[model samples]
Target: MKLALFADGHVGTQIADWLLQHYADDLCLVVTTQENSITEAAKQHDVPAVAFRSEQQVLDFAGTRSIAPDLGILAWWPQLIRQAFLDFPRHGFINTHPSLLPFNRGKHYNFWAIVEKAPFGVTLHMVEQGVDNGDIVAQRQIAYDWEDNGESLFHRAQSTMLDLFRETYPKIRSLQFARTPQDLSKGSFHHSSELEPASQVFLKQTYQAEELLNRLRARTFDEHPSCWFEADGTKYEVRINIRKADS
Candidate 1:
């Protein structure tokens, strides 16, 4: 039941802490980007941690340590793992994605889900070379009302993903689980650049209120770029604060 973990960012830190607390004995190595909270968290647990910038570095670290992990877990990792490293683990790899795959398969999935009106959810799947095109292990749909926005949806997906891991880890540990192949025809994948055009709002043109609102909500990640429009050579960023109406 030995495991290797690859992750970064806030969700990654939380997953790392959970692994340390619950599966300390089984964790063999942890990989994260350099100079981040996730790296610090792993070190605090006294786990063998490496900050890798590329796939080659990961291979080098494993070779140096003479470590062969039984399973590899990817939580909030931003890079594409090479097949050679994917094969290093005895049981291959599993990843957590913030949307119901084969929909919203790439970056900013939470934003794309709302904008496209796709099935909003989180997915745990077996990792293959294709981006998020993997066999599904488990998934759960998240509900959102009119009050929900990009920031709120992102947080909800993060929490649900963690919960899914907690619920499914036992079965994975025992190697007693089923894998469901995703129906590729049923959904779509978006590249990082695909989201660019959606981020721009045209103020001069008449747009449906719902469409305008969805765009505002989709692009409104905290500290990231906001939905914007240019009017009279002046650019304006849009933010929404929705509340339930009195019954």
Candidate 2:
């Protein structure tokens, strides 16, 4: 049950802490990107920690240290892991994605789910070379109301991810799980740049109120760029706050 963890961000840090609490003895290495809370958490737990800018660096470091882990877990890790690294772990690699695969396979999956009206959820899957196009190990659907925006959806997905990991980690540890291949024909993948053009809310274009509302909700991430449109050479970003009317 030796584990190698690669993760980033607040949710990543939380997952790392939980793993340390539950499987401290099995944790072999904690790998993070740059100096973040994940790195700090590893230090707090006194777990061996390292930071790598790319997948190659991780592979190189692990090779140099002769570190061989039974399982590699990726929580909110942004880098693209290749086959070499995937094979480094005895049981291969597992990752938690914000959306159910093979839908919303790329960046900003939470935002894309709302914008595309796709099934919103979280997925734990066996990592392959392709981006999020992997065999599903476990998944859980997240519920959202009209009041939910991109940031809220992200938080919900993050919570679901942790829960899914907790539920599935035991099965994985015992090697008592089945691999479910994703239905490639049933899902869609998008790149980060693909959403940029659609994120613009054109004032001159006649869009339905619902469409505009969905756009605003999808793009409303905290401290991040929101949906915008230019008018009279002036750009304006739009944010939506939705709530049910008083009964």
Candidate 3:
């Protein structure tokens, strides 16, 4: 049961470490966007590692590998995986997504959850042709309060997602998992391009306080680029921290 891992970031490093410790012999390949902890772990274990810069490189590598993987795991992947690469793995790929399916299907799951008042959670699903329009293997709906901001929600999702992968991957490896298709009409999707327009704060435009606050808190992640406003031919980014009033 050879496996391939496509991963990036902190959660990606965690996933890579777990796989290396538990299933080192079974890990056939490691695909990454940059040299990080994931690549370093693969090196220690002697697993084949490649840095993918383009969709074409991924496709070309797929064609050239001598051993085809039985399954692929996508953890915090940065690229848009197409059907061509999907077919390279014998059993296809499964993704550990940060949002509950049928809601916030694309980028910035944490931001969209608060902005749109959508249900937030983590999902482990089969990676299909569409952007996260995959069949669910398992999921957990997270509870969030008004005090939760973009940074908090993002960390929560990453933690929950990693836990989901830990619990679900064994079932997946044994071929005991099920695939439940997502209803596309019920969910919202966003492209990377959508964030700019949504994050723009028109100083002259009137907005309901609730709506404006939602937008502010949604983009409140300190590490990420924040919502912005322009005045006097200058642009300024804004991020707000929310909390319950101190007793």
Candidate 4:
């Protein structure tokens, strides 16, 4: 099985390591967002590694190959994968997205799930032209509590995503997984730019208590910028921590 891995971050590194160990001969190329562990592992094994900046680069590389890869895996990939690259992989690419597909299709899935009070989960799906609009290969719906802030949900989703990938590997290898086309109408889509505007707490505008809490908690990832409000000439960031009172 000739394979190409387009990956990033911890899950990406883990995938690369597993492939290098179990399917070294089958791996043709490793495409990473930057010089990370994925590239480093590929380097150690002398596998071809590239940080592709454009769709044309991927096309050119595929053109050089006599036979396209059997499959490609996109784990935590950042950019939108174009059709040219999608077509190069024989069985098409499978993406490990953090959100339950169709819903929260683009960026900030963790944050949106909380803000919108939508279904929160992880999905492994076939990569189509659109952002996370793909046939579902596998999915795991996660339930979040009021205690689940953006940071908690983010880590939880990542953990679940990796687990789903591991459990689904055998099916993927055998090409036995089902591709159920997502119902495009049922879920929501968001852009990366939408997050900032959504995160703005309007100081003057009245909001329901629940609505205000949801907005604050959704953006409450301590590692990143939190929800903010403008006061006079200055801006103030706010975050919340929810816990049950002990009896």
Candidate 5:
């Protein structure tokens, strides 16, 4: 089956490369949000790359395109596609999301997962009119170690997602797979850029020491902002390096 891939950032490189390698014969219409490794990597593979200046522009480009997509897979695409572009694909759009669906279905999910001390994993789901709320195609639990930080956890998800994709692709191609409906009661909706470090920390959602450390280690990456907390009118951002104590 033909697949259209949308991706950006470093995770995009891993996902795009895996797709190109596994589906060498599959035609992929690559959509990108910026000039990044995903774009460069797609170019290296000789795949057609369409760069959009903004999310709205993405919709416009999809509107102009005559070719219809069988399956659309989003790999770290910074821009959100509207329903029009989403409907272009007969199967709608699928995203390699970082959080477990019907729960952590929003931005900064990893952070929230660690903060909430919930199991972290990947969700390959159909993108609906709502955010990450479509029916779930497949999911896998992401493992973590005592010393694993956000960067490590992210790479773990990347590799895990690739494996899940390979195993689920045939099912998707045959259109024989069933999607589990998400329970709206367990669903969470996080707004974009909702909370910064300086934002007031409501005790209800705040974590203790080790829990906070675990959260910090599991969320912030080299590109995303680092986690920070304040005490006694002084604010301190988490800076976990190669060497650190468990405590």
Candidate 6:
């Protein structure tokens, strides 16, 4: 598909790089929020592109492309896509969300899924005016383990997303894929601002040290593990570096 990619950070950069490397002939324009590492690399590859502070710039740039795309996919766009701006794609527009949709529908879902012990999956869906409210194209549920932490979950989910696009989006473009409206009742959305609070583990709630340790390992953040508070006037917190999955 000739694409005009609208995206946010690293995922946008990485996915654009993949498309640029594998399907350069089809990429129309790559639109991103700012010039970051991905944008730098995009320039190195000499890809057609635009970086802007607002979605309007992306919209205006897409207007300049005479050729249409077979499928337009949003990898990690932070901004919203207004209807007038998204109709540029002739086939349809699809998006890759970190969490499985109808559930974990918004940002910081990776950390939330780890904390909540929910499945870490990727959702590829049609783009709508609303947040992640679109027809489901494909989703792959990955089991979250006792040792699954925020950064680990993100890395694993990141790897799965491209595989998802390679496997699913192409089929949808070929019309061999089916479209199904999500069960609105089965899912929920969580915003980014709500996730800024840190997780605290209390020793008092623990039934066993091993179980508590297991759950503690499950909720570790990228920079640090969940801070633990003790009944005494001292704290016991762990900063996890290496991921030592149990053999």
What are the TM-scores, per candidate, against the unseen true structure? Answer: 0.93, 0.93, 0.91, 0.93, 0.77, 0.77
TM-score of 5: 0.77
Clashes of each: 0, 0, 0, 0, 0, 2
Per-residue accuracy of model 2 over 1-247 as CA lDDT, tens digit each: 7889987887788888888888777788899888777777777777778897777777787788788899888988887887777888898989989998887888988788887788889999999988898899999988777889999998899888888898888898877888999998987889888888989977768988887888899989889899998989999988888889999
lDDT of each: 0.86, 0.85, 0.88, 0.86, 0.71, 0.71
Candidate 1 vs candidate 4: the lDDT winner is: 4
- Tens digit of per-residue lDDT, candidate 1, span 58-177: 778888988889999899988888777789789999998999888888888877887888888899999999899989999999988778888988999999999999999898887787
TM-score, predicted candidate 3 vs. hidden true structure:
0.91
Span of 10 residues, lowest total lDDT, candidate 6: 195-204
lDDT of 4 at 161: 85
lDDT of 6 by residue, 42-160 (tens): 66666667786666656666567554666677888776778886676776688889888877787777766755556569888889888898998899987775556677788888888
Poorest stretch of ten by lDDT in candidate 1:
35-44
Give the deviation of candidate 2 from the true structure as CA RMSD: 1.7
Better of 3 and 4 by lDDT: 3
Better of 5 and 6 by TM-score: 6
Q: Which of 3 and 5 is the better model by lDDT?
A: 3
RMSD of each: 1.7, 1.7, 2.0, 1.7, 4.2, 3.8
Off by over 4 Å in 1: 35-46
Q: After superposition, how far is residue 77 of candidate 4 from its true place, in Å?
A: 0.9
Query: Candidate 3, residues 92-169: lDDT per residue as tens digits?
Result: 998888999979998989889999999999998888888898899999999998899888999999899888888887
Writing each residue's lDDT as its tens digit, candidate 4 over 151-232 gives: 9989998889888988898888778899999999998998889999999988789999988999899999877899999998
Q: After superposition, how far is residue 139 of candidate 6 from its true place, in Å?
A: 1.4
